[model samples]
Target: MEVMDLGILSLVPAVIAIVLSFVTRNTVVSLALACLTGTLIAGQGLLGFPTLLKTSLGSTSFAWVMLLNTFIGIIVAFFQKTGAIQGFSQYIQDKKLSRKAVQLVAWFLGMFVYFSDSFSPLFVGTTMRSISDKAKVSREKLSYIADSGAAPVSVLVPITGWAAYLSSLAIGVGVIATQEDAMNLFIKAIPFNFYAVFTIIFVGLIAGGVIKDFGPMKKAEERAIKEGKVLRDGAEPLIGKELTEMEPYPGIKPRVFLNFLLPVMMIVVIAMGTYLTIKSAKTMEAFLFVLIFMGISMFVQGIPFKVIMNTLTDGVKGAVPAIIILALAYSINSLSKTMGTANYIISVSEGLLTPQLLPAIIFIISAIMAFSTGSSWGTFAICMPIALPLAFNLTGGDVTTLVVASFAAVAGGGVFGDHCSPLSDTTILASTGAAADHIDHVKTQIPYALICGGVALVGYLVLGFMSI
Candidate 1:
C-alpha cells in the first residue's frame, strides 16, 4: 500500500481508540490499542509487526524520550520514599502557612522541576497536597497550579529538556540558524505566552482568596470541608491512612524543619548547577548529568540503596503509560511524515486560508487534534512540520515570527486540549496526585483553560495581522 493510503487508514484505529478510552475511562488500554493499530497501518501487513515494534524501540529519539521520563520518575519516587515529600508537607502544615504562600511555594517548586514536564505535575501535586488540604484549599485549585507550571515553565526555560527538543525541531526545518538561536527565540517568546501567564495569575488569585470559589469547584470545596473530607476522591482514601503511618527516617534524629528544608535546598542547588553546566551539552550528556544528580541526592537523603532501587523501579513502572503514549504518538507522527500527510495538509490549505489567519487556523486544528488525541507532544510532533512550513510561507519566509507563532500554536493548543481532555496523562496524573476525581479535575480546569485560550487566540490574531 502507498504511504498516504496507509496514513489515511491509520486514523481509523487511532480515532476508535480515543473514543473507547473516553467511554471506558481506561487510558492504558486505549493508548496501547491505538499504538498497535498505528504500527499495523505503518507496516501494511501482519508479517511486518515485529519490524514495526523493533523500529520504535530502536529509534534513538524514542530511547532518549523514554530515558528522560524514566529518570524523572525515579527521582520523584526517591523523594517520596525517603520521606522527603512528606517531611516537606509536615513542615508546611506546622508553620500554618497561608494558602497563598503555599501555592507560591508549590509553583516555584514546579518551576525548579521544569527540566522535565512529565514529572512536574507529579512532584508538585504529591509534595504540596497535604499543605493545601490542611489549609482548606481545593484539590481542583492544586491541579490548576500543577498544570500551569508543567509545560509552560519547561517551554520558557532555555536549558530544559523541552527547549532542547523544540530547538532540534526548529533547526530541522531551517527555521533558526542554530539550536542556541532557537532556544533564545523561545525564551524571548515567553512574555507572549498568554496562556501560561494568565493561568499562573489565576492560580494566584484563587490562592489569595481574591477569587474565592465558584462553579463545581466551589461546591466541592464546601462539601469537602463540611463532610470532613481532606482528599477529593475519598473512595480509595489514602491520605489519612498514609499520614498516620508516615514516620521520619529510621535512626535519624528527626528535625522536622531540617528534614524538609534540606531536601528542598539540595534540589534547587543541584538543579541549577546541572542546568548551568549542561545547557551547552548534547542531549545525552544533559540527561546523564540530571540522572547523576538525582542519584546522588537520593543517597545523600539517606534513602537505602535497596529502597532507592525499589522506588526507582516503581517510578519507571509509573511512567509505563506515559512512555507508551509518547512512543505511539511518535509513531503516528512518523507515519504521517513518511506518508506526506503533513505536506498534503499544508498544500491543500495554503491557497484557501489567508496568510494572517494561518496561525489561528493552526491553533484551532492543533487544539482539536490534541483534545481528541489527548497527547500534547504527539500533537506537537504531528503539527509542527505542516505548521512551520505554513508559517514560513505565510510570512514570506521570515523565520523568526513564523517560528514563534508556530511554537505558540503548539504550546497554546497543546495545553488547551490536554488540560480539558479526560484522557490526557497529565489530566489523569493531576487527579491521582491530588487524590481528586479525575473527571472533576477535567471539569474544573476547562473554564480556566478556555479563558486563557481565548486570550491566546486574540493575541495570535493581533500578531498575525501586524506581521502581515
Candidate 2:
C-alpha cells in the first residue's frame, strides 16, 4: 500500500480527536472517531475502518500492553482481597504521623512502587487514603501526589515496563540497534527529563509544606483543614461503590510481606535481574510470574479456588475500561502513521526547525499530542518514532546533546500531558484510589502540572541552545 500525501489534511484526525475529547471527556469515543476520520481522509472509505483496526490492534506490541495491564489488575485485586493494602494503611495510621508527615510518606511510597504506572497511583492513593484523611489532608492533595509520582517515577527508572517500552522505541533508529543501546540512551536522557523531575520534586515540596499550596488546591486544603471536610460538598469520588464498601475475607489475617511486598519485590528483581544478565528486561514475564505466584500463595493461605477465580474475574473487569482506551489508542496511532500526520508536520516545519530549536519544539508538540490523546504510552508510541529520527538527522546521526534532549523532551512531555488529562487512566485511577472526585483531581492537578511544564519548556530551550 502506497502512502498518500494528505498535506495539511492529515491534521484533521488529531485535531478532531483533541476537540472531541474535551467536549465528551471520553477518550475511547474520541480515539475511535479520530480513527474513522483518518480512514476516510486516507480514501480508505467506511470499510477501511475495520481493516485499519485489524491492522493496528492485531500487532504483538498491542497484545503485550493489553496482557500486561490485565495481569496488573489481577495483582491489584489480589492485594485488595488479602487485605494487604488496608493492612499497610493501618500500619501507617498506627504510626500516628502528622498531616505533613503523612503527605510526605505517601509521596515516598508512590516513588517506591515505581514499576507500573497503573499500580503506583492505585497503591499510593488506596494505602494512604485513610491516613491522609485522618491527618486532615485533602483528597485532591492526595490524588495530586499519587498522580504526579506515578508516570514521573516510572519513566525515570530503567527496569520497569516504561523503560522497556521507551527503549524499544529508540531501537532501529541511528546507532540504537539493541535494547542495551536504547536503554543507555534513556539513562542519559534522565537529567533532561525535566518535566518529570520537576513534577516529582514539586509534589515533595508541597507535601512537606516547604512550598505553599496555591490555586484550587489551596482552597481545597483550607477547606479540609478549617472545616474537617476532606471533600467538597456533594463531591462524588471516582471510585465505584463496590470498592468503597468492600471488606477483606473473614478470619483471614493480612500479611504485608507475604501478600504484597514479596510480590512487588519479585517483579522488580526479575525485571532488573533479567536486564542485567540478558540485556533485555522481561517485564511481561515478571508480571506473569507475580500473577501466578499471588494466586498460588493465596490458595495456600486458605483462600478457596473459587473465590480466587472470582477475584481474577473482577480484576479483568476492572481492566476492561483502560484496555478499551488502549486498544483505540493503538488504532488511532496506526491510522496517524498511515495517514502520515507526523510526516506532514515535519515537512511543513523543515525550513523553520533549527537543530537548536528542535528540543523545545518537539517537547511542545509531544505535550500537545499527549494531552489530546490522554495516554502517555500512546503519545510515546506516536512521537518517539518521529522525534528520534528527526533528532538523529539534525545532529548528523550522532548521539549528541541535542538528540538526547529531544528524546527526553518526548518522555517528559508525555508525562506532563498525561498527568493533566482527565481522560487519562492513571489520572482516573489516582482519583479512585484517593476517593477524590475525578473532575476535582483534574482541576487541582493542572495548575501544578502546568508549572512543571513551563519549567521543562525553559529547560528544553536552554538545552537546545547549548547544543549549538
lDDT of 2 by residue, 355-447 (tens): 788898888777766765566887788789988998999778999999899899999988888788665668867876787876788888999
Instruction: For candidate 1, report its TM-score.
Output: 0.76
Q: Which ten residues in a row have the lowest lDDT in candidate 2?
A: 238-247
Counting clashing residue pairs in each candidate, in order, gives 0, 0
Model 2's TM-score against the true structure: 0.83
What TM-score fits each model?
0.76, 0.83
Error of 2 at 193 (Å): 2.3
lDDT of each: 0.63, 0.82
Tens digits of per-residue lDDT, candidate 1, 422-445, equal 656566555655655455666677
The most accurate candidate by lDDT is 2
Over 4 Å off in model 1, which ranges?
1-3, 6-10, 32-82, 99-101, 172-175, 179-184, 212-216, 230-251, 255-275, 278-352, 372-375, 378-382, 397-407, 421-432, 435-440
